[model samples]
Target: MICMDTTTAALTRDEIARFHQQGYLGPYTACTPEDMAAVRLRIDAEVLTSTGPNPASPLHSRHLDHRPVHDLVTLPGVLGRVRGLLGDDIVLWSTFLFNKEPGTPEVPWHQDIDEWPLDPPVNLSIWMAIDEVTAENSCVQIIPGSHRELLHHVPSRPGMVFSKEIEPGLVDTSGAIDMELAPGEFFLFSEQLMHHSNKNDSNRRRLGLSARYTTPSVNIRDQDSAPCFPGHACVLVSGSDTQGLNRMTEPPA
Candidate 1:
């Protein structure tokens, strides 16, 4: 199911102000709950037939190779908000599925910029829920205004998905907000935001899709420069890549 065009006004001045202050914005509705159910069914089928050993592995960067994901990431509702933050010229840098099955280990607190190689790190990540997310089911939680400066991270504990996590005593998370989202809803956040999730203590699984976007002016390292993956690809989601720094890949037919 395709996302519906958001008729609501683009991020308001107050909303943008809040986002700048808090490092994140919205659980905005992109698709109807019924539409999300259909999309989830299609994603499930793709996962079953995927080549990689697990859903997370095979579906990483699926936006560049999967039609539904390609369309989803480029949806006006998604891009409009991003454009509000990152400007009109946008490059889809990456995509991933963070599907946590019941009893999965908690994701360690970390900042996304630490793993990326872009100079002067700048990125906005849109995380869309494929299933209802709540505190009990490990919805995203983040420390408000943590994106002002890069924080130090240490190696993550065993069984965690990421290799690094925020070092102890670096930032107090006593006021971290639980970002509960319904199916088809999403939030836009700064890549440097210190965020993580708890283990899914509920019976149901938790599923989310993330699309990372950046302006074309940001110079992404080429494949030869310690690439994140051996064959990482990017897509020009909007405007032009005036810098011509990235090797843009065409979306799958």
Candidate 2:
């Protein structure tokens, strides 16, 4: 997952302050309709179809092509926010898509840091919507100002999983912020913040991409790199970057 260097924008002091204060920020848009459509079409055409109870609810790890997702993760604005959250020393650690198909099981309430083992638990997920998502269709629900607490738990299923449970002492936000958005919109959230979505009952499929990035300062040698796809390889499809850090080329499918 290579990306050309682009002029990096630091998350504003205010935005950083806000993220620290709230569990998440957005319903923000990161790509144009056509760009998003191209990615969705590629996903539809290339996904290896499957069906079953995915304990990693809301996500399908095996049926995806990560190379295409690289572009989305490295967009200048997206990267800027990430650097703001994690700092400039960054590396693309993993990527996966969670498609909440109609009638799928509900995404139980949880926190991202609990799901992962990133010590010092400072990370964010850029959740991009591939379809229109809403509370009715099981869009994301977040507990505000909850990232301050560290959590404990097991997987979403009996088998090993990536999410963690809210510690017995913490408050849950699974019923808060019934927010949704159209395709191409996204949100940036802390791994420590408690959040989850509902089962999809609408006629439409609620597909979304989750791309994870780590700060250069963080030691990622032991992380789960297996589920990540080479999704950031096309970071500069719209133009060229003068900075050496911006040179990712999209792979031919």
Candidate 3:
């Protein structure tokens, strides 16, 4: 009989080994069609009322009420993959509804851990695409195994390819993969990896729900605290062990 438990349903050995070697896995589909519909509805509500980009946009923070995005936080498969990476003592640290409208500028090349205040730098980001994400429309570019190396990079121009111009001496991105995700598909990656997205030149807008998870031992800073939706959310799913995972309280910051 097939075991239907999440912990045991963890990623396959090849998957785990690949992640260890490459530092990221998937385009994983965690949400069902119905779930995707619900998420789109919720995001639509925010889009309808929004005056500008979501707070987590790094460039804009207007009309930041992203409460409608709470569902992705409680998603089961997402939490499972997260748990498989970090073990059972997880504490959600932040959430952000990341969006890039047509003509949006290119995000600078940098590691997520560098932007946030954390020690030992062990955290994962789950980037969930709510719309079709393609290389033509400003897809995310990641350094395949850069998570193993730590490099310092200056911020790029608001809408320019900072990585291309300065990355030669700082870090090598030759084997990097430009991830293309569909609605309901997401990628989980470590914060140490060098990653950035180009300006969205496509006619359609590109939207992703980026959620950050940290171990309980990781300390939270006060300033960074206000940015993420506050509070702890625990929605029990399968298994006797909820270790290292649970629902997120805020949408991506």
lDDT of 1 by residue, 88-189 (tens): 899998888888999998888999988787866888999999889999899999888989888898998788877889886786889899999999889999
Better of 1 and 2 by lDDT: 1
TM-score of each: 0.92, 0.73, 0.76
What tens digits encode model 3's per-residue C-alpha lDDT throughout 14-75? 98888888889887776654557666775667554564433434422221334445456546
Query: lDDT (0-100) at residue 225 of candidate 1?
Result: 42
Best by TM-score: 1
Model 3 CA RMSD to the hidden true structure, in angstroms: 6.1
Misplaced by over 4 Å in model 1 are 6-9, 52-56, 224-227
lDDT of 2 by residue, 21-56 (tens): 996777666776666787788667655353212234
Better model by TM-score: candidate 1 vs candidate 3: 1
Backbone clash pairs for candidate 1 read none
lDDT of each: 0.82, 0.61, 0.64
